[model samples]
Target: MKSHWREYIHCDPKILIGKPVVKGTRLSVEFLLGLFAEGWTEDQVLENYPTLTLEGLRAVFAFASECISQEVWYAASMVNQTQ
Candidate 1:
């Protein structure tokens, strides 16, 4: 069976002020997502972050996809701030 990304990504409320992190580590999903937003290829990301495996990288994509699919909301203030 394939590993579910959700199994690896979760929030700690105490750590990172509640950001979603990889299971058993302090790595945040947003950190991985930021790499993609910055144009880092999977190979590049893996090369730079030797701790992350291809599966973990794929998990980032899966996790983000699920979040957006599950009624993600963009606060008006935050949206405006981005503009």
Candidate 2:
């Protein structure tokens, strides 16, 4: 079954100023994405941050994909308009 991002991700004003984060943890989606961008593998992340699970990692990607898709749609809509 496809993992739902909402199952593992959360955002609260009390947490990182409402940045989307892994539920029950303070790890932000942006921070996790940055780890991968910096060449950290799944094993590296899991080993270093035992609190994070494989599913939580997947949720982070899912959340980011959703955000990018929305951004892409908005950008496409403005493609023909003057900046």
Candidate 3:
């Protein structure tokens, strides 16, 4: 398991408005995360989406983690000052 989202996921302006998706599939990372949020198990996800692999699922999480980790949260006061 490389644990690298880039290895399994990609974004294209031609696909889903440039949202990240598993390679070779139209499924978006947000959609998959929503499925898990709605109580869909890994097995169930795999069963429903045969094109998705365990590695791809892991990549989704990895991509999300990277995105969250890189996010910058601005303070309300700072935002107000900038306005």
Candidate 4:
């Protein structure tokens, strides 16, 4: 969708002690990641957080995916060492 997920995830020194949170909401991307990891569905998350939208959820996932992807090189190195 050519989306700018960065718009949805950011940290501000003045807010939440600089945790990466949703841009317009106080909810942190880490919180959402935890919910998803705990087996919470997108529908369930939205139901619990009426302020959140599908787009927001998608953005968080995209942002997290990008961050995790950057960590892949380290994992690759570990895998190479084990070979």
Candidate 5:
């Protein structure tokens, strides 16, 4: 997935309390991702949410990938052992 998510996703304080959502829709990226986590296929999602496009779905994943890539993580044991 590329950075194309920028074209399909937007954040607005007025929308879902600033949660990132699909452009022009109340569909939050978190919500879409949750559907997938709950075992929803791309086809199922599209069928249920008629307004969502294939590109939009792909964007959700790309956005998530970018977010995770920019974060930092450490093992709890590593911190405790250091102390």
Candidate 6:
């Protein structure tokens, strides 16, 4: 089955400088992640952003996980090297 994140999150150039956002809302994924970093609970987030659903929250996490998993890292010294 398709991941819930794929269904719930999207990026549009016209929205928040193309940041990934919850579908049908202007809430950016970065903002959502920040809330969690600030110690906001799932219930608190739901209460504050009434437009967001539990599944949407899960999607945000999933999207972040997917992004991190696919990221490639290089040492700072490698910046000057050519392929």
Q: How many residue pairs clash in each candidate?
A: 0, 0, 0, 0, 0, 0
Best by TM-score: 5
How does candidate 1 fare on TM-score? Answer: 0.71
Residue 49 displacement in candidate 2 (angstroms)? 0.6
- Superposition error at 82 for model 4 (Å): 12
Tens digits of per-residue lDDT, candidate 5, 1-83, equal 56688999999999999999999789999999999999999999999999989999899999999998899968999989989
Identify the candidate with maximal lDDT.
Answer: 5
> Candidates 1 and 2: which is better by lDDT?
2
TM-score of each: 0.71, 0.82, 0.82, 0.77, 0.87, 0.82
Model 1 C-alpha lDDT per residue in residues 1-83, reported as the tens digit of each score: 02498766778898798998876666789888887899988899889877777777777788888778788699999999999
Candidate 3 lDDT over 15-40, as tens digits, reads 99999999989999999999999999
Candidate 6 lDDT score at position 82: 55
**Could you give candidate 4's per-residue lDDT for residues 4-32 as a string of tens digits?**
88767789988889988878787888999
Q: Which residue pairs of candidate 5 clash?
A: none
Where does the lowest 10-residue lDDT sum fall in candidate 2?
68-77
Whole-model Cα lDDT of every candidate shown, in order = 0.79, 0.89, 0.92, 0.83, 0.93, 0.90
Candidate 3's error at 58, in angstroms?
0.5
Model 4 alpha-carbon miss at residue 18, Å: 0.9
Give the better candidate number (1 or 3) by TM-score: 3
| Cα lDDT, model 5, residue 38 | 100
Global CA lDDT of candidate 1, please? 0.79
Model 4 Cα shift for residue 11 (angstroms): 1.3
